[model samples]
Target: MMLPLLEMTYKELADAFTEQYKKGPALAKALYGEFFKNLNPKAWQAEEIQASPGLADRLREDLSFSPGKIVDEIHQDGLTKFVTELADGVRIESVILPLKTHQTVCISSQVGCRMGCRFCETGKLGLARNLTVEEIIGQVYTARRRYGRSIRNVVFMGMGEPFDNFENVIQAVRVMSDQRGLNIAQRHITLSTAGRIDGIEKLAALNIPNLNLTVSLNAPNDDLRGRLMPIHNTVSMVRLQQALRAYPLKKGNWLSIVYVLIPDVNNGPEHARQLADWLQPLRAKVNLIPFNPGKNAPFRAPHETEIDSFRRQLIARQIQVQKRAPRGRDLMAACGQLGSGIRQQGLN
Candidate 1:
């Protein structure tokens, strides 16, 4: 006879163990091992678990542990989500964005970021830790099971720097994109980075087709960039631009040059000219992201008139530019703003 398989995730298993045995993961593991002591390892399979039937109350009463808010979000898609809190404390925030067209799962490479880009909320937390390969892939599995939606896009612009944790980051990417696994089309995937020079060179070697890139270029030059994004001080503008110019991927659309326009800092006409002069020869389209300050950020959005003038400069220079509108602000979930507790804390 085939052995009975355990249907719960690592998180659920750990949680259940704590409730029943009162403080012993080993005891729980041994008990669970006994429960599945039959013979067929190959038959054990993973599935998206949507419902818990009547086990919720019992489990809650026993363990006093509950699903995180992100778990609720996943279930909103009418699918099952299974999350695993890895041995490491690197919290993985993930969800399957279910839409009529396609499904996309956002994955975090690090628990937090060390880059400390002033405009980003995740950067404010300080660096916690880098996620392992299994943790990175867990985000995908959780999303796939919860909504039964086919995830088409994989964006690296989540909780941490994908390139900083290069080895695991690349390994996870390879595993997730493999034909035997998620098999998501390269065209639908994008990797966003805050200008990591060596990482750029490493990515260039892959030369994966249809894999798009987005560089966070908030300032036009070294002086301004160094002020807003400390990474600029470490990775000089000359080196970053050289990386962009020599990026291995063949052409399609210009790589997205994300420029976050703070109210008075990078919004003036002179700033635009400087930006245009720098970008006129680069192979990229500019994406103007109006600065939306977080709880502790010292920034504000630019005025419409000032933004219009900025766009005109790029257009006049024959450089493609698009001022991207802010979305999910009601949830503190816009560009340059993620995991900021804007939603749950009701900070608005």
Candidate 2:
């Protein structure tokens, strides 16, 4: 089988070039620049390839470049949710979020989610499979090259629980943050998880520089959280908090705790106090997301007054909190709103 060009990191690509073609690191660097920076596949045919003989033919014979095709693009208020059909016909949705300065692409780590969060639309569709490295990176590439998006940040908060597909997600991150390739700074990349302790420990061991970790913590107490998120049944809030505390965060960096404020379910004053108390020990900020009601959603969004009151309650307890504004709701691309609707329609 031919090696996947998109899956290989700079070091692996360099080693491949040196071992297969007896080319130096410079050739690998040039090839990496052409493939990732320049977004060119035929780097060996470019003028820079003069230094490395037979490199073009070697790449042609030994490497494969396959990217998912964008079948649908749904545009809403400054957000475009694009669906990419993979080689195996499994489809995934990714959202292009418009920030003030630069764009952020919310990419999926799996086709459907197994986390089974009661409030999320993606959880409605059971896990199909984990996306390969190419499929993961292809989302960003398609956003940048095909749609002409100026993507500055990437978030793993789209479809599946990122830590469940830990190896592939981390490999994709390495390929993305490679200086010679996508070159997205580690600080610009955010991996959101639904409280997976083992994955948290593994991430701490790898210690990717400046990578931001966001925990999808909806409820404050164990009983409420377990009811809202099934993952809590296995990984409790206590263990999750311990893992977060052990995570090696650089100076000036803090964890982002995402609390999806479902009306009456997890938005009461007592819930807010419990959440604040739970977060008292950690250097973390709360991103309060008012639930975006999806199809057949069991919970409704909190009223504006309730949302404000919850925020104020946290603030009163000296917690740093920011209310997340809902984006791409009409298009079903908002937080906890991504699902497999397009795939079910057989759009591919």
Q: Please tell me which predicted candidate would have the highest TM-score against the true structure.
A: 2
- CA RMSD per model (angstroms): 9.9, 1.6
Identify the runs in model 1 with alpha carbons over 4 angstroms from their true place.
Answer: 1-90, 95-100, 342-348
- lDDT of each residue in 150-229, candidate 1, tens digit only: 66787787778888998887776665565433555677777889999888888888877577888988887889899888
lDDT minimum window of 10 residues, candidate 1: 41-50
User: lDDT by residue for model 2 over 1-348, one digit each (tens)?
Assistant: 466878989999888877877878987888788788888766666566755566577677776777788888988899999888899887899999888888999999998988899999888887989989988998887788865547979999999999999999999999999988988899999999999999999999998859999999999999999999998998777888889889999999999999999887988888988999899989999999989997778888788898899999999999999998887678899998887465356433
Model 2 accuracy (lDDT, Cα) = 0.87
| Model 2 spans > 4 angstroms off | 50-53, 343-348
Task: Evaluate candidate 2 by giving its C-alpha RMSD to the native, one decimal.
Answer: 1.6
* lDDT, each prediction: 0.64, 0.87
Q: Candidate 2 — number of clashing residue pairs?
A: 0
C-alpha TM-scores of all predictions: 0.73, 0.96
